[model samples]
Target: MKKYIAIVGSNSKKSTNRQLLEYMQHRYVNDVEIEIVEVAGLPIFKKTRDMAIPEQSKAMATKIDGADGVIIATPEYDHSIPAILSSALAWLSYGIHPLLDKPVLITGASFGSLGASRAQAQLRQILDSPEIKARVMPSSEFLLSHSLQAFNTDGLLIDAEQTKWLDSLVKDFAEFIDISAQLNHTHQEDDTRMADFSWDEGTTDKEVSK
Candidate 1:
């Protein structure tokens, strides 16, 4: 089964972003394994000195690296992605580049009219950086504006139009993951083939150990 990790990009217990991710987890758990993760356990990122990563951050990186794709649901904080989300990304960008070539989907819920569009846009730009190289789902932005009033008594999204839109985004994301994985696999195979002969001469012991 294809597994996807959903990240709640907030530290607040009352975060609506976490609520939105929980709804998604409940809705899609049966179809695909969905794990909602948070970054509260991780220490703030420091680039100056600490080379050794924390245990919690390592575990988080492993989960993200093993997943077929990732979904980040964040609440807009000052028209940008939350600070916690940025800290988590900084950790992931440290060693093995866990996000490299992985499929990612960015979404959010907000009380304002624009939803979290600005935040998601900033997130997409960061994810597309040459260092990260993540393949973000580009079909449409799933911004749940006025999100507090967007749900019904049954805990389901009340807007039929937005519901359909989200469903389409999920489907497209799945397809994108499949295709991206195949291409990455092909590239890795080619790299392995080319690295097999005369590849030892240019490598340091540390590189060879990996």
Candidate 2:
């Protein structure tokens, strides 16, 4: 079965970052299924007590685990990613790190001139940690500054050039995932062969050295 890909946005309601995610989804012509995991309903993460995690949080974790790659769309607030997004990250970290070793692409949009660049940097740091271990996209694509003017009321991207750029980013990300999977499979096969060879060599060396 083709693995699923997830697009996560910090905001639940109509958000420019969500619109950017939608634009990326439009680029998919392949068989892989893409699902959007909204982080709106999850409660703020707390480390002191065993905070009863909401069902939505658990569902998000399961979806992330099942996904082959994740696209994170977040908006900037006070020069960093929204608190809700951070909380979701915390939740994911505590249990089974769904994001560990996962390929993740992150982008953001805002009304300011910086185009949510600060938030993107902060997110990159978070995702780069050992716990997350995500392969981040290098090029900063899908950063729609003055976002209110870039997208329509129906959440469609209004700028044709921006849409094209985002499409290219998504296509590249998909190809990257495919190549990574192939490399991993090859490594596993090599490991299996090496194990078998090691067993046979050990038996032969013991008899010869005797």
Candidate 3:
């Protein structure tokens, strides 16, 4: 079964972005298993060259490393992503760099007309960092503007058009994850083959000295 991590950027329990992530988990949109990574308990990252990151945060990175893909639901804060999410990303950037080349899907919900598009773009920049290098899905953007109206009291999307878009996004994300994994595998195989070939062609030290 495909495994994924759904991350909500906001720290608030009543955050609409968090609600959206939870809704995705409840739906299991693409027949995949999801584990929601909560940002509330994470320690705010401090840039200290000497100190190791919080153990819990390190463990969170490890969880991300194990997942096949990540879904980041974010909220905008003055045309940018929330600080908690940025801090989490900072923590993930160092150490083992668990998010390196990982497949990712990004979405956001907000009360404004633009939803969280600007925040998502900022997030994409962070994900594109040299240490992170996350592979974001290029085509789909789930911008839930006027978020409260989009969902019903039961926490389900009410509009048929929006529902259809979500379904397609989830399906595309799943396929993207699979295809990326295959490509990584193929690259690894190629590297291994090249290494083996190089080893075979190398002369022994004794022969080289002669």
Candidate 4:
């Protein structure tokens, strides 16, 4: 069975984003294995003098590296991803690139009608940045609007159409993972270049001219 890491991109005790992933976990139990990961206890991102990465961050990166693909469920705050999720992504990228060329699927939920659309767009930019380089599924998005009423007591999606849409998207993601794996040659070259690049190193204009 193909395994995926589903990141709950929220720190709230009662986050609807978590609920969305949990629902996927249960609904797709037969089609795929989904392990839901939390981002609650990670320390806020900061630059250390020694450039040390926290053990917790390393552990999360390990999990991501082991998984076939990733699913990020985000919630919008002030039309952007919550600070906690951004911090978690920062930790994952600093000096380590587990997400480099990894396949990713993005989902978001919001209480209002917009359904975290802005946050998801911002997240795509972050994941596609040079440092992260996550291959997010193209032209695909799953947004749960009015999320407070979208689920039932059992944490299952109440709307049949929504469930059907999710089912199709998940299947597509599985195929996408397989296709991405076939491009390992390119992925390797990108990884090598990323490993050689560093944000801390830069040349002056004089050095560039020389």
Candidate 5:
């Protein structure tokens, strides 16, 4: 069976983002193997001289590296990605590039009508950075708006239209992984660049920002 990593991009105890991913996991149990990974409890990322990262972060990176594709379900905070999600991504990329050339599907759940649209946009930019460079599914946005009421007692999506849309997106994402693999001629180049990447030597944070 094809394996995919579903990242719960929230630290909240009752995050709708996590619920959305859980629904997908249960609904697609026969089609694909979905492993839901949590971003909670990870230490905040800080640039260090030794470049040492936490073991948990390393383990997550290894999992992602082995997966066929990735699904990130995010929740908006202050109209942007949660700090915990940002920290997790930073740890995954510092001196390591498990996401490089990996095919990714972006999903977001929000309490309000906007459905984490702004945060998803920001996350796309983050994933498109030189070190990460994940092959995000283009022109696709799965926004779970009013997510609090999106699911039912059985954890299945309540609305038929929304469920159909999500189903189609998942099918498209599976095909995207195969297509992205065919277009992976630059993988070696990206790996080489990521291996050589490092924080600006001897530069203070303030100076770098200037």
Candidate 6:
């Protein structure tokens, strides 16, 4: 089966972060299927809420669980990711915990000089929890700035230099995903062998006693 990837961002409309994600999707072509997770309809997370989560939140969690890797892009608000992203993260921290040990690549774009540095930094901290073993790319290599003019009307990256850099980033992430999948496969094999060995040992001991 083809590995699935999920891309998420804070905006619901024509957002620069969304544009960057679309650009990345295009680069992958048929190698992998990329699904964009919509966070717009998620209700603000509240622990004391009497109502169940919105359907959108459930859908987002399903997508994250099914994806081989997740990519997050966002705009900086008050030197951090928007509350919308935070709320989504909090909501996904419930049962199943799909984000735990998941491969994640984070990037962002903005009109400010710091690019989405502050927001990315905050997100890195959030993902640093013991439950989440994320492979966050280095800060200098992942942040994209001055996004207002960086993309074309069709959401394609037009700058040759920037495109090259973005391509490199995506390639690196693809390699990381490949390695992670291999490790998971190996771990599963080891687990299966261990289970079989235990069963065999039990059978041999029973035969010896008989």
Return the TM-score for each candidate structure: 0.84, 0.77, 0.84, 0.93, 0.95, 0.77
* Span of 10 residues, lowest total lDDT, candidate 6: 193-202
lDDT (10s digit) by residue, model 6, range 105-177: 8888888777798898889888765434455655433677888888877877777887887778777777777
- Candidate closest to the true structure, highest lDDT: 5
Task: Compose the digit string of candidate 4's lDDT tens values, residues 56-162.
Answer: 88988999999999999999999999898999999888889999989999999999999899999999999999989998999778999999999999999999998
| lDDT of candidate 3 over 29-137, digit per residue (tens) | 4688889887877877764534468886787888897899999999988999989999888777644467766899999998899989999999998998755678898
For model 4, state the Cα shift of residue 89 in Å.
0.8
TM accuracy, model 1: 0.84
Q: Over the stretch 18-126, how does candidate 2's per-residue lDDT look in tens digits? A: 7676655654636456676788877787643333566777788788778888888878899999989998887776544566657777778898877888889899999
Q: Write the residue-wise lDDT of candidate 1 on 1-210 in tens digits.
A: 789988888888877787777777777777678898888767886643325677777888789989999999978879998888888887776654677778898889998999899999899998887556678878567899998898877778888898888888888888888888677755565334433534235657665555
- For every candidate, C-alpha RMSD to the true structure in Å: 6.1, 11.4, 9.7, 4.1, 2.1, 11.2
Cα lDDT listed for each candidate: 0.79, 0.70, 0.81, 0.91, 0.92, 0.69
For candidate 5, list the clashing residue pairs, or say none: none
- Candidate 1, position 139, lDDT: 54
The regions of model 3 sitting more than 4 angstroms off are 185-210
For candidate 5, write residues 29-66 as lDDT tens digits. Answer: 99999999999999988877678899989999999999
In model 6, which runs have C-alpha deviations exceeding 4 angstroms? 1-4, 49-51, 131-133, 137-141, 182-210
Clash number for each model = 0, 0, 0, 0, 0, 0
Which model is ahead, 1 or 4, in terms of TM-score? Answer: 4
Candidate 4 TM-score versus the reference = 0.93
Cα deviation of 55 in candidate 1 (Å)? 1.7
Candidate 2 least-lDDT 10 residues: 193-202
